[model samples]
Target chain A: MISDSIANAPVPAAAPNPKDFAKKKRTNRSAKLKQCKLDARREQWLSQVKNKGSKDESNGFRDSSMHERDGSDRSLENLEMRQRGEENDGSIHHDSDLESPSNSPTSNASSVLGGNHSGTNYTGSSSSSSSSVGCCSGCITEEEEDDGCLDDWEAVADALAADDKQQNPSSDSSPDHEPVARSDSLPELTNRVDSVVQVSKPECAVMVPRAQVNGQAWRPDDAFRPQSLPNLSKQYSFPMNSDRHYGRGAVSWAHKSVISAPSSCPICYEDLDITDSSFLPCLCGFRLCLFCHKRILEDDGRCPGCRKPYDLEPVEGEASLNGGSLTFRLARSCSMITRS
Target chain B: MVDFARVQKELQECNRDVEVSGIKVSPKADKLTHLIGTIPGPLGTPYEGGTFEIDIQLPDGYPFEPPRMQFSTKVWHPNISSQSGAICLDILKDQWSPALTLKTALLSVQALLSAPQPDDPQDAVVAQQYLREYQTFVSTARYWTEAFAKTSSLGVEEKVQKLVEMGFPEALVRSTLEVVGGDENLALEKLCTV
Candidate 1:
């Protein structure tokens, strides 16, 4: 919470010089993006290192697949974009996003529509390779959907069975005959399988802008614009925009959420005069009366509002400067040693 | 700054409607930082007719920070510590919002008396009893309420008189009674230690 205020306090400070502020903000954003990229790469490297000791063959396969995806990098970009959609929920908007599935599902569907819109057709080799990855993601989605209905898992099992059939085409050269027999036996199951196949197919070649138009019809105010970017930059930059919005707006949101000038002490439930010297130390903006503040500090310097430790930087600095060591550098070193 | 002005106002506001709310707040000492809160046990529960006293300590960040409150009156319940009288309610900790007052908090405490959340318990033994032997837990809670909370009842006076008869001076017995908030068994325990 304190970090949030530290991030946004400068926005209002630099408001007078709008041009400089904008430039500085952009640079700050880029720096954040670079940091995120480094963090992702570091995590990937750590995971790879961990896996290398256990399964060298699996690592080789993963590396080869990554290389193969790199050739038709557009498909790889699409996958990354979808992954970003998944990551968005895990980050800043986690609470609200999970609470409101209607919002995320529609947005996801729109983005998928946009992806298909941007890329007309995937090359045969790229399509085949991406289909496997897509199937895995489809299975994951199916698992998530299973929470809503038990039948979704059955549908996913059927999809997996079809996948197994595809892998062993030599054993059952008449794979088409089995699927047809199953489809005829259970039309409803065939319909579910059809939806699953559509999800896994990278060659959805057509984008229906009209689907997005229908979505917009329900909520005209929702700015549901279709994405047309077909390259890696489009997918890569998606997270950057989200990260920028999340970093800036979410900070301001937290900063604004707290009652900076509360009318009363929340603990005692008493009204205070506007001029009372309050202990508005933490970003939670909870104020303590002087007596309460002194009493609390006597026990521990945690913010009563949130039970966070008081950031005692100035106090620590003063202690180091005044007591024990007289020489300033020596005092600093002594304080550091004592602190450790 | 213990917003003495606000605390004074809250005390007045809380005590003013004691008849209606059955919740009262008063300063324990001259300082506003330390206070006492009284919440009548919720109606129609095992704690019915019992008055629960809660110790209130105002931290530095009074309104922003949640007020520190613990049960001074010991009774059997899952969410309240059987030994220390520490309550395990969300509002008394991180879930506390500034919008809540001492009166509201006391009301919440009273509500907790009626509805003990065994799933998130301060006393694991009590919670287990509540979940596994619910009828036994209720009777035990009711018995504790009768033994401790009913200060006006002759049963408590008899216990106090009996302790005094056992050669503990009347003043020490009375003082122990006050310390244990009229819990006969606990007062006897305190007097025995003395």
Candidate 2:
């Protein structure tokens, strides 16, 4: 699971190292090395944390004050060792602390390292972790734990733990806050986060990131590149498949409201990069690209979101994009959206 | 597929106001798709003083498709099945919208307890009794709630006997127990209020 998170971390940008700029491909190799080191440290940190938690649990009843003293002493030792490690690794200590996992030895280590690393590398990781911990941890965890269904819950518990740390500073601070650059892949990030987490302690999973967690799962990995969506102007609105609704006289004003078209269709999961024209037969917040809309109407005019019988009517309005009609024609050429 | 991002958000949003709403949602196990929602029965209803559990299953086409929900706790309501606990709410089926959430849906379920739709019955027998024999329905619902929903912390008999010996009739003590769902203190409060 830790390795998964390390893999997803943006390879520290090589732009700062002028020599690496000329050797772009080599920068990838160096980033891989850094990730490898981070992974190793993460495992070491996790093992230490497990040991600490077990020790605390077992020794809690005997004499809690004594146990707390011992725990703090050990924490101080760990901090000293981390500082030594940082000296050996340079600013990499700051990097590691920023992406530190919670209930972690690094949290102890970072408190000491913070005095030194706070000045230079504090902005990105510290601010992001402090601010986005409640919201982004689940998202980052879900995205990282794509294959492990059960780990999603752990991630959620971890998110709750993060919240607890935020609410009451006495609890363990989450060390693993990798500042993911959202602007580069906002939609893709949303798609990945949308995969969901397996929450072991559902009670703790609070504070939903509304903008990112709105349920729109973007699937057009190839089509959603920022460069492809150049002309937002030429998009045209298409009426629902004429065959879907027979009774509504094709001209009812009630059915004429235009859907604020989504960039992609739910039916085809295709982005408007290729097919710009979209139609929504109902105001149920679901849109099908013109191709899927036509097919649904031809077969059955039922709204998928709300199973009510639906009909599409073309409204005379300002055309949104130029490539709308062409995109519909393109989608018509392929039969990828036939019902099961 | 399942809108997991929405699920995560819904959980966070639902849990944030847990204190105010007294509604809780958590994964049944590790899986996000299967969840359990807990709602306290509304005040001034047959189900008052009880807690109800709901089972939630997120479909692959979630947000696009409504979540499948059923009463995990045995509920005596017209729109909820007494046997299988299937709910008869439209939002769970054909009347769903992508905009609606698991929290909202559970809120609706809680509301259904206060204002039951006997006309659209999931359990015909319960609905029929609810309409025809409203008094019997209330007593039976209260009794069932006391039997099933309660988790009495105090030894119930001592409290019941104590209340009975305090000059209240034994029948009144028992009925108060049914009304307060076995909370000794609440039953005493009901006795005092009456």
- Choose the strongest candidate by lDDT: 1
- lDDT (10s digit) by residue, model 2, range B19-51: 999898988767899998888989999999988
Clashes of each: 17, 17
Against the native chain B, each candidate's TM-score is 0.86, 0.77
lDDT of 1 by residue, A158-179 (tens): 2222343332222223321222
Q: What is the DockQ of each candidate?
A: 0.11, 0.05
User: What is the lDDT of every predicted structure here?
Assistant: 0.52, 0.50
lDDT of 1 at B106: 88
lDDT of 1 at B72: 73
Return the top candidate by TM-score: 1
Chain A vs. native, model 1, TM-score:
0.21
Error of 2 at A294 (Å): 11
CA RMSD of all predictions = 29.5, 34.9
